[model samples]
Target: MKKKTIIEIFIFLLLLVFGLHSDAQEDHSKMNMGQASNKDEPRVTVDVPQDQQSKIGLKTTKAKKEKTLHTIRTVGTVTADQTKEAHVHTKINGWIEEIYADYVGKAVKKGQPLFDLYSPDLVSTQEEYISAKEQKSAGSDIAKVALERLKLWGVSQKETDRLVKTRKAKRSLSFDSPVDGFIVNKTAIRGMYINPEMELYHIADLSRIWIVVTLYESDIATISVGDDAELRLPYDLNKTFKGKISYIYPEIETETRTAKARIEIENKDQKLKPGMFVNVEVKKDLGEAVVIPDDSVIDTGTRRIVFVKTSQSRFEPREIKVGPRVGNSFIVLSGLKDQEEVVSSAHFLIDAESKLQAALRKGESQPAGHQGHGK
Candidate 1:
């Protein structure tokens, strides 16, 4: 009976210990569940006193729908306008006797004498015209044919009349410039034999010029003819010339993987010279978009953050998706709305406080997957 009593007491003691262990485990599991539930609910609010705000120059601006211009900047080169370019070629084979516009870079005006050429064929045609006139058969078909031949050869009617009045064919005929421009190229020389195949002079009017810029395949779609652009010379930054996109080449350059865009600008002052490098800005109107001051947003490489004012002295950090930036603002694509206010100046000070508060909250929160053990 004594051994039975001892065994029964021992079994009761074991049951008591096991019951306490299970109760401790249940309590520990409940505590862990409570902590885990709170881990994901980290706090993210910051309060700045009035004095602190004033000290940091913290300022806010209300976001609103505003018309903005998206600019694409690129480098380009100035070139002569091809349509205004003139290539001087001889209509008949001749020998250059005199060169008035003798050298490259010389400015020439319309109807200005460029050079004098002597061609036997031209002299012969003039003599025939004079003979037709002397016969008083100038109105006859033969005389008309002679006059037409001289005209077809680029002989002016004045020169033909001079031949008729003098009854003598001049050895050389003077040729005048057809346009007012600078002589970009000149191949005609005194006493040099010339033919129609030779281009004697290349004149280009510099009053209007073209700036050809290269655009990547991605940027080409946003550009079109008649889009406004601004051009600035590398040497001159203060002055900007207004221009328009006049043409876009259909073919893409294979080596550079870019397409060419032509911008026409008036340079009546002749300040812009061909072959000079220039900076081009093509502004595209994005219409109405949600915009905030440029200084309002903080760009962390991984994401963009902006401190948004929730109430007086209270701010919240918001991650936003942003589009192209305009002059002094950014196009907010998401995470913001019109009429909302955001910190615009000295927001770095507010940002630091907000991030610190968030970090502390995260540290205070218990780990989600942690399991507590019972003593």
Candidate 2:
């Protein structure tokens, strides 16, 4: 009887130990499932009372599809239009006999006499042409060749006509201005010897001017040829000038990482002088896109989040992909729908509360025994 009683007690003890082992396994499995469920759950929305929202100064703006207008403001320097510039040089070696356009900045018209030049070569060519005319008809081959040589030697048409009419070689010939412009540079002096290689005058037409502006690499895509720009002089804020982008430089500056763009503006009044600094504003329309106020975004380094108003008092934290910022708004590439209201002000506090609530919920889902396991 004692042996059978001892066997029964051992069997009972074994059953009890197995039952405890199964219970422990069940608890561990339940804990793992609860943690997994918490991990897979979506982010929860937070609710704020109306009075609390007023105290926090919460403001909301609706995300909507609209044209993104970006204004790029920069500084530019005025420059002369290179296409309308002229460098006056003589084709023959000559002595300056007289100077009519005497000073720099003097405006001269086309065909206007700039100076009188005396050259032995010119005089000899003229004499030969006169002799050829005397020996043969004016249209004869020899006479034509002599006349052509004189013309190639830089003798003006008017001077040639005079030589034909008078049949006399003049000692001094007048050199005319080739274009209507102000002489920005002058190297000619009375009695100074000049040659074909010498530049006598540098004239520039200021009727049209160029404003060169520097654009950062980020802003290069916002500008294009024919885009309108507004320019304002630093000295004259009340006066505004309008222009259009005429060219964009192909290469970017390595040091500054910027490129240059040229804006053409009419300067018929000659008010915009070269080298003057002006403010430039270029407005670019980036077509239509979904956008939200810039203040509504919460950038947490790894990702961007925005609080979307789902109901009267509920704000849902949503992750979104955003593009470039346009003015006070941001272009939303995804994650939010059009016409959805987003919190634009006082969202930081809401974000803090939402994080706190999430932490509490995660703690509640954890097993009670494991709650203080790390500590």
Candidate 3:
């Protein structure tokens, strides 16, 4: 009887333990089920694969390490180099009795007779010289010295030598030009009276020229002496003139608010004429400025956005800070790196595609039995 009782107790204890284990397992399974339900379907949807995002009609350029630059261009006029310009004037009071110059556009050489003028003061002086030579006295030689004085006053050898051979006082004497240049200005007409200190003509030496370039107030800082410049004139389409920055105006233009920069250029061929219209571009170093192609940027009022190609098909829009313009590029001050890739062309199309894809992914994140399914 005892042995049978002991066997029954052992069996009873085994049954109770198994029953508790089963209950514990059931409770654990229910907890696991609750935990699985907590993780719902993704909150949004993504239709396009991540690999094909950036290929939506997008063109790109690698961010390069380059110097930054900023410059301004303006319309300018060609001017005569002031250092080479001269005005021809008459020192002796006279009339334009006979103008050997003939016309306004005549070329004259140094010591060449330009016009003849009749003056009582001149004729009397010549007569005095003749009388001095005939008397043959020391005092008379002093008077003859007057004849040589005419030569000192720009009388050519041909004319002065003739005066000695002819021994006759010419009614009018010739006045010569002091320099070789074109007659840029002619104030005295054929018969006009020319007074002492009268400006008869203006001769401009055309071998050198100047270009007056205007720049916006902002660009005045980059231009400096010795910087190189280029000009394209309307008359010469195939030609380009090189020049150097020579001077800058102290003040800006009142109406246009621009600073005028003077560039000196050599025109030994006389191709650059005064008042000629030209386009000028200046080149300078901005000193390691960050930059990108001019076409790579899109400016919205709130932000300046650039499309960065993160991977083969993933383009991300990033807000960037730009400094200034340098020819066909912009100086990227920040928000980009040297080796990253950015969309340089066709960025607008890619922008639209990325936004649309983002919206679609957001919609598909909802579960099949949850909200937004009907739409």
lDDT of 1 by residue, 272-305 (tens): 8899999999999889999998888887665677
Location of the lowest summed lDDT over 10 successive residues in candidate 2: 19-28
Off by over 4 Å in 3: 1-62, 67-74, 128-169, 285-288, 293-323, 333-337, 340-375
The lDDT for every candidate, in the order shown, is 0.77, 0.80, 0.67
Q: What is the C-alpha RMSD of each candidate to the true structure, in Å?
A: 15.1, 14.2, 20.4
State TM-scores per candidate: 0.63, 0.76, 0.61
Ranking by lDDT: 2, 1, 3
Supply the global lDDT for candidate 2: 0.80
Say which candidate scores most in TM-score. 2
**Weakest 10 consecutive residues, lDDT, candidate 1?**
20-29
- For model 1, the local distance difference test gives 0.77
Clash pairs, candidate 2, are none
Candidate 3 C-alpha lDDT tens digits along 263-362: 9999888888888889888877788865678788877554566777655544556768877678787777789888788878766544444333333444
